[model samples]
Target: MKHDRPKISDVARLAGVSTATVSRALSAPERVSEETRAAVQQAVEATGYRLNLAARNLRHRRTGGIVALVPNLANPFFSQILSGIASVLGPAGYNLLIADTRTADAQTLLDYAEPSRADGLIILDGTLPATALQGRVPVVEACEWVPGLPAPRVKIDNRAAAGLAIGHLADLGHRRIGHVAGPRGNVLTEARLSGTAEALAARGLPFPEEHLYPGDFSLDSGREAARIWLDQPAATRPTALFLASDAMACGFIGEVQRHGLRVPGDLSVVGFDDIELVAHISPPLTTIRQPRTEIGRAAAERMLACLKGETREADTVLPVELILRASTGPAPA
Candidate 1:
């Protein structure tokens, strides 16, 4: 004969508590006392009992799911952030659903935020319109944020980070500096570009329109920028460059080196986002380091708080650091 499956009643009996108490501890854990939760957990382990999430969710009127909206799933920069979110939500009995918003239309994004689909949302795409998310599920913005959304956001100071990059190059006696900017209409692109301008102005450095190269935070764009730079006269070229993303910086460096250029000796380059790949690249990159994992964890915590009716309207800004490497040096004489 087949043995019976372990049930809530078994857990309750083993923990010396009523089935009602066991149910609360397993489903809405915050409602139960710490001691009760611990006892129920021990009992669950002893009896090899597992929670029936479907039945519990139905009874509690919860979807037991959280959705995270990312701009690009293929980018390695988002990997650590997603991992941080999963670490917190997994133990809390919530399933994480990831959606790539890059190609998703407005309706498709709205559907993901529907009450029947997910209980909460973690948004990493700031380009989304505020109207799309108005009056939907509770949301916590991570890394990027929509302007005037009133949602709790966790991110680093993009402008300040940009300043750090420009300052580093300026201090190295590089008089002429150039910038590779992110796409227009992006929040980060605007912030970082403005910061670069401000830093240059503060130092009395010239930044003509020609010095700014358009980029989409992609390697291809960086390679294209490299081509443009190579076409310019050597006497007019900027001695140092600050790129918005590490991928673009690497692309620019690779392409220029192909034409027999040496980094820092011929031109110095700095990048934003100290991705893992940057450290291992040829002539390791100097970049601004963002606490990507911490941003995700903080966003997840804020999302959980919103779901629990402990909502706050505060924005959390994490710190960034300037990481020096072999990619930058004093300007060539």
Candidate 2:
């Protein structure tokens, strides 16, 4: 009761053609004579032969797969990005492997290009060394990038986007503004922090040396920043604070409330990365909205182009939008 499956050899024999002719007919039918193609079709139907893509790819030395590595997979910020990547790769018959790199070492990143692993990689982390990425497999950096490393990248103009936040606060008549920047040594931290300072100076405003706080783009860091702000006397404390992320903004607002300070009342606040939760919080966060999904889709497409041996510029910068919501208001009277 065991039935054998039909193969390409059987189809070629039935069509009275050589195996090479059969392959050309199936893969590049336009190149074959119409009569040969028609004969191959008839033979294919008669023998019920289905092409084996795995076998063909094996012979071609292709794994038909790619990989995506992110700094933290558990973070909700990366969900839409990964979705965008799959949308493109799925239709092209390529499989995607998501790699969580919070614990990845230098060797782990370097080993991504080894044989039988993946054809290419899309890296979301920006801190990896350039030495770890020199390999035959292609790599594309998305959202964040390490300075001085040469790699194709898709990201927003961080400095200009941060400037927009500062300009908004200034427009609201806030002379005393503080900034909670991302981790030190991070490219984003340098860009946004410099942008904040530059925007302040452009408006004839001065930044107190002690007003800037270092944050790791985490909720806990935001809470700690609020405490530091509170330690200052009310007269010297900044009336407005611009945090690097929505999660931090939410934490700052929550922590300040515990000290009987209300957002936009006792202290006006602004945040970056207008995540969905920011809109539903007690006071909606007024922040810059990054096109996270767009960045991912563009990165995926760019990676595909690289795999085809196409060369591209090192940077692709996207625009950002500032959303004004309830969290920010006119400086307190």
lDDT tens digits, residue span 241-286, model 1: 9999999999999999999999979999999999999999989999
| Candidate 2 clashes between residue pairs 3 or more apart in a chain or in different chains | none
lDDT against the true structure, per candidate, is 0.92, 0.87
After superposition, candidate 1 runs with Cα above 4 Å error: 28-34
Write down the TM-score of every candidate: 0.97, 0.86
Alpha-carbon deviation at 333 in model 1, angstroms = 0.8
**lDDT value for candidate 1?**
0.92
Q: Write the per-residue lDDT of candidate 2 for residues 1-333, one digit (tens) a residue.
A: 998999889999999999899999986687899999999999999999988878876986878788888888877778888888888887665788888888788778877766577888888888777677756588898998866667799999888998999999999999999999888888888888999999999999879977898798889999999999989988988999989888788889999999888889878899988777889998888999988888888889998888778998868898999998999888999
Question: Where does candidate 2 stray beyond 4 Å?
Answer: 1-53
Local lDDT at 12 for model 1 = 95
Q: What is the TM-score of candidate 2?
A: 0.86
